[model samples]
Target: MGTDVDIALLVKELCHHDAETEWIEFKTNNSDAEMIGQRISALANSACRLGIPTAYMVWGVDDKTHDVIGSSFRYRLEKRGNEELENWLHHQLTDNASFEFAEDVVCEKHVTVLMVQAAFCHTVDFERVPYIRVGSYTKKLREYPVIESEVWSRITKSDFESIAAKGGLTLPDALSLLDFPKYFDLLGAPMPQSRDEVAHYLCDDEIILRQDDGRYAVTNLGAILLAKNLKDFPTVARKALRLVQYKGRGRSEILRSKDYEGGYAVEFESAVEMIMALTPSKEDIIGAVRVQTTAYPERAIREILANALIHQDLTVTGSGPVVEVFSDRVDFTNPGTSLVDLMRLVDNPPRSRNQKLASLMRRFRFCEELGTGWDRIISSCEALYLPAPKAVEYEGAGGSVRISLLAYVPYRSMSLRDRVMACYWHACICFTNGETMTNKSLRCRFGEGGPSSSTVSKLLATAVGDGLIKPVDPETAPRYMRYVPAWA
Candidate 1:
C-alpha cells in the first residue's frame, strides 16, 4: 500500500490513461471476490509477458469516462468461507504470489487500489488454473494455447545471458569466433595447447554448451564478454558500446564517433583509452611546475563503463550502452534502469541484472567488488573537487540509466544551489567518516589553495542560511567551527 497522496495521484494518472492496458484494470464498485482474484492472476501473468514490474487493479474509476464515482467495495471486509478476501486470494495464488490493496479518498470519492507484483520466473495461477489477459477479457490459460506456450517459455527461459547465440559450431569455428587468448590472459591461466582443450575449458565455464547434435554453441555470455567481433553475433551486436563526441553541448555537431565492436573483455581497455583521449584535460600549476590531469578521473570513467556493461538489461534489444561527450560534460548511458535505488547507489551492495556478466567482469578486474564501484566514483570526483556525478533515469519507450560527469566548472561560476548541494554532499561524506565539515575541510574539498578560510566560511554560511547544514556545536570556537548535514 502506498501513501494516501500517492494513491490519489496514481488513481488520477490511471483515470487519464486512454484505455485499460494489459497490466491495468478498472472496476466500478465491483466487489465480486472470485472475479477479482481471476483478474489479479490475469494481470500478473500479463505483466510478466509485457516485462512490467507491477500490475494494477483500480476500483472507483469509470472504465469508459475514467470518472472517479467512488467505490463502495471494501476488500478487507469481504470474506470467503470464513477467510478474509486478501487471505483467501493469497491462498489461491501459486508460487507465493502476493499483492496489496490501498484504500484512500480522492476528490471526496473513496477509491481502492490493488497492486500486484508481476509473476517472475513462473506464471501466476489461481485455483490451479492459470489465467491470461487477452485485450480487455480474462480467459483461462488453456483457451489461449499460444499465450500459454509463450508464458511458459518466458518463465522457463531463465538466464538470458546463458542462452546460446548460435548452435552447432565446430571446435575450430568456436575458437575462431572468440578471442580465446585474451580470455586465458585475463584469467592468468596458461593457454591450452590443443583446440579440444580450449573447447572443454569454454564448456566448463558455460561459455559454450555442447549441443545435442554433438556440436557446440556460443552462449550470449561468451559472445558479449569474449567474442572476436560482437557484430559477428547478430543477436548481441546492438549491445556494443558506442562513443560519440560532439563539438558542443548538443548533438548537432559531431566531432567524432566510434562504435566499439568486440567482446567487452577485449574492448574494455581500448574503450577506456579512447574515452580518456577524447576527454579534455586541465593544467594544474604547482609552485614552480605545471601538471596535467584529465578533467574526469580515469578510475571513475572505467567504473561507469564497467557498470554500463555489467548492469544493463540485456533483455532490452535495439538499444545499447552509449558514451556521449559534450563540451561541458560526458554522459555514459546503458539500457534499462538500475535495480537499486539511485539514492543508495553509493553505499548499497550493487544489484545487477546480469550477475554472471558482473561476476566475470569482477574476476577480470574490470570493476571493483560488487558494491564498491559507486563509492570509488564518488570519492574520485570528490578528491578532484569535481561536482558529484549526476545519475538520471531517462524514461520513454524503454528506460535507460545515465550518469553524467561534468567538466571542471569554476566555483565562482556555480549557482547558489549548486554550491549549497556541493557543501551538503561534502558534509554527508565527512559525517559518514565520523567527522564533521569544517572550513578547512570544505576548502580542501573544493581544492582551493593558499589559505582561503574566509571564502570557505562564506560558502558554509550560505549553506547554513539555506538550511542545508547546521553547526555541529554552537558553542565551539569560531576558529574551530564545524558543521553537519541538516538531517544529521
Candidate 2:
C-alpha cells in the first residue's frame, strides 16, 4: 500500500487510544492552521528525538485539560490548500522522509493525523536550506550548529542502501520485473542457461534479494539499472531526460522537446545517443574539402549525461530529470539539488545520493570512477575551445541542479572582458611545457595573428605590473616570452 493508505489507517489508531502518552497526543479544540503546522513540527521533531518510525497528532483530545473533547474544527477545510502547511513543516524538519498526512474518524468524530515517518539518514535541505524547530518556533538550521553538525555527520557516514524505507518493497519485489537478458547484452556476457543460476548471478551483483515469501524482489538499485521501464515504480518513474530547444539566445526560442523514460543505467546510452542526434553540426575545413562536426564534442555529451544519471535524487517523486536543448546552448537540469557547494563542484571529489545506482552504472561502463567526471567534463570542453559546461544549483521550493553548455559560438556575446579571459586561459594551456600562459602567446593562442612584435613585450610588462602573470625571462633577445602557472 502507498504511504497515503498507511497514514489513513494509522490515524484511526491514534483516535481510538484517546489518551496522550509520551509519544501519542491529540489536539482537540484548536483548528488554527499555524497551530496545526507548529504542533505537527513539534510531534515530528519529538518523534526524531525518540527514534520512533512515526509520531501522531490527532484531534479529539484536549491539550491543557487532557480530556476527550473530540475536535470540531473543520479538517475538511484543512486539506483544501494545506499542502503549504505540510510544506512549511517540511522546511523546518531536516530529513528526506516520505512522511505523509491523512484524515480519519473514530467514534464518528473528525480527527486529523500527521504520520511523520522517521528522519532519513542524510540531512534534507528544505527551501534549499535546512531548518529546525525549537519548542514551537522555527529557526534556521545553522542556528543550531550542533544539530546541523550531527545531521551532516550522520549523513556522510550513512550507506545509501541501508537507509530505512519501512513498508518500502523488499529487494525481491523490486527485481521481479527486470529483464536479465538486456543486462547480459549490455555487459557483453552470455545469458545463464538456468533460472537458478541467473538469479544467483543477479544476487551476487546485488541486483536482487530473496524475500521471506520465497520470492525475489529487485532493489531500487537493480530496478533503476535494469527495469524494462522505470514507470512501474510510481515513485521514481521516467524522471530522465528533458530536452528544451530555443530559437535565439538565453532560452528565448521554443523549438523541440523530449523526455527519456527507461532504466537510466540501461537507457543512458540511448539518451546520450539522442542528445548527439540533437546537437547541430558545423562544417570545418579539412585540406581542400570540408566535413561537418558537432558544435560541442561527444565527450561533453557523455559527461553531462553521466552527470545527470549519477547525481539525481531517487527519493523525489513526480518530478524527473530533464535536458533542455537550446539553439545556442544545452541546459541539463536534474530534480535534486547539488550536495557540495557550487564552487567545489568542478574541483571536489564526486559524491552521489544513489550509491547502488552509481555503482551499477560504473560497472556497465556508463562512466569512469568518481572525482574524474568533472575532470573529464571540464577538460573535454576546454580542449575544444567550448566554454566548459557550467554547474548551477538552485535551492528553493523543490530545488534544481543544472549544467549549461553554451553550444553556439558566442561571437557577439564574446565581449572584450571575455576575449581577454579566454586568451589568458588558452595561453595558460600552452605554457609551462603545455601547462601555462604568457602575454605574447595569448594572442597567438586565440587565432594566430601573433601579437605585434612590440605588443607582446608591452602586454608582458603590464601583466607583471598588474600581478596577473610573471615573466620568467629577463633577457629580451629573440623577444623571449615564456610563462608558467602563476598560482603554481
Q: How large is the C-alpha RMSD of every model relative to the true structure?
A: 18.0, 8.4
TM-score of each: 0.65, 0.60
Q: Compared with the true structure, what per-residue lDDT tens digits does model 2 show for residues 1-488? A: 12323333444434454345434556765666655544444444444444443455666656545444556765545542546555555555554544554555555666655554434554444434544455435555577877666555555554434322222233333334677787787778899887787888887776665532233445556656676666564334556456666676656656777665567766777777777778788788999899878878778788777877778876565676777776667777877888786544444667887777677777778876566676566556665556545677887646888887765344344544444434444444454234555554554443333346465555555555655455566574545566543443
Candidates in order have lDDT scores of 0.80, 0.58
Q: What would you estimate as the lDDT of candidate 1? A: 0.80
Deviation in Å, model 1, residue 228 alpha carbon: 1.4
Error of 2 at 228 (Å): 2.6
Top of the candidates by lDDT: 1
TM-score of 1: 0.65
Error of 2 at 363 (Å): 2.1
C-alpha lDDT (0 to 100) for residue 263 of candidate 2: 70
